[model samples]
Target: MLKKQKVSLVVLTLLLLLNIVGILNSTQYLLKILFSYFVLIIAITFLPFLRQKINYSYKLQEILFGLPMILPIFLFKLKTISFAIGKLKHFEIFLIYLLFLAVVLLLLHHKDYRMKSSSPFIKLSISKKEVFLTILGMVYSIFTEEMYFRFFILSELEDYSYYLKIVFLVFSSFLFVGAHYLNKWAASMFTYKNYISQFILSMLSGNIFLVTNSLFYSLILHIAYNFPEIWLILKRLKYQQLHYENDGAFFDDY
Candidate 1:
């Protein structure tokens, strides 16, 4: 079992390195997209095997308790939910889940606000293939990331002391954010916003995994958080195409 854990950790680390290289190297878009899906498939396969081998127990209570951890941008809201959960009845787990959905919606609104105000209107000439690949890559990338940082790394440190857990959390969060920082999309004037958001989400996802003992909660939150950003990107691409055809040299203006 120990040997398996060690091997799993090594594999995850190597995968992380490969993912970073895929982001940093100026590769073809299709290749990058394919690589992202490949890494995600490996992560999805390995995480479940490792979890079973390690006998990781997931509890319904922990999953409910962890739902509020998604509101990392609103710490006070999370704290309130955490406090309220203890007083609620066992049947109120459903209520808590409903509340979690509400919080997710609110967070999505907040994300939309930030994205509208901060994200640059890049005049992209993306084809249908590129659009499909980008969306697939984004979803796959998120899955791979949550599997590695939350399920693999954080789960392994579960038996450690609080201090040790915190140390690993910070280390893993740095790696998560660093991966994004190295990405081509984030290497721009507005890069700091991406870095800050990624760091906070990484920390929050780690905490969610700690509380829930399940990767599903964090994975849902990650996808919810990214949905608006992806939509905006697609909308902008469509808008850019319309204007580019209407006015020649429209791309040059941006």
Candidate 2:
């Protein structure tokens, strides 16, 4: 990037960060999305590569491919796994499956982030069924975000100088971390200590897209890296829900 471009990029990166942080207190999901898109619109106007009309035909094709996954989310909402399990034995089968998932998640997050809570930003007193639903919802979000960042955001910087792309890479990584702060679990999830892993994971997803030019590869990585944090969030919700239930089953190992 030219010296002036570098300076301007710094200013825009800060503006974008501020825009993201502005949604920190917002609880309405749809409105936060609108505000972020508004910022992106303003950003593209100043960004030379983005000043031209963007070809969203690619986005349309992606949505088509994503439909197979989208259908299951709706099915889960209609009739969840928790709804089918009746006996303790059945629940054990479910729990065993989740344990396998937990093993994969542990490989992703390591064990250090299991710190005791500093109180949540907002508590969700949710149930087993709700936990599955929330995770299904996160699956949808992972798809949306991978499309937005690895696909759309990176496309905006195509052919830009390598240094500028790296800057945007870091900026995009922070955007992922900023998203956690926007969550109800923010108080614990967005602590600066976790930023290192989050950045590495974000960069890994971003760089993989650049290498393969395929959202499919990057999307899977995003899900793999994020599943552990999602598990932690679900566990915390369960932990908080226990406060309201006299007979809540406790899983001591999480």
Structural similarity to truth (TM-score) of each candidate: 0.46, 0.44
Question: TM-score for model 1?
Answer: 0.46
Listed per model in order, the count of residue pairs whose N, CA or C atoms clash below 3 Å is 0, 0
Worst 10 residues of 2 by lDDT: 76-85
| Model 1 segments more than 4 A misplaced | 1-130, 234-254
lDDT of 1 by residue, 48-103 (tens): 45556776653322232233222221322211212122223432443454356446
- lDDT of candidates 1 onward, in order: 0.54, 0.53
Candidate 1: C-alpha lDDT: 0.54
- Candidate 2 wrong stretches, greater than 4 Å: 1-109, 112-128, 182-185, 229-254
Best by lDDT: 1
How far in Å is the alpha carbon of 224 misplaced in model 1? 2.6
* Candidate No. with top TM-score: 1
* Candidate 2 lDDT for residue 172: 74
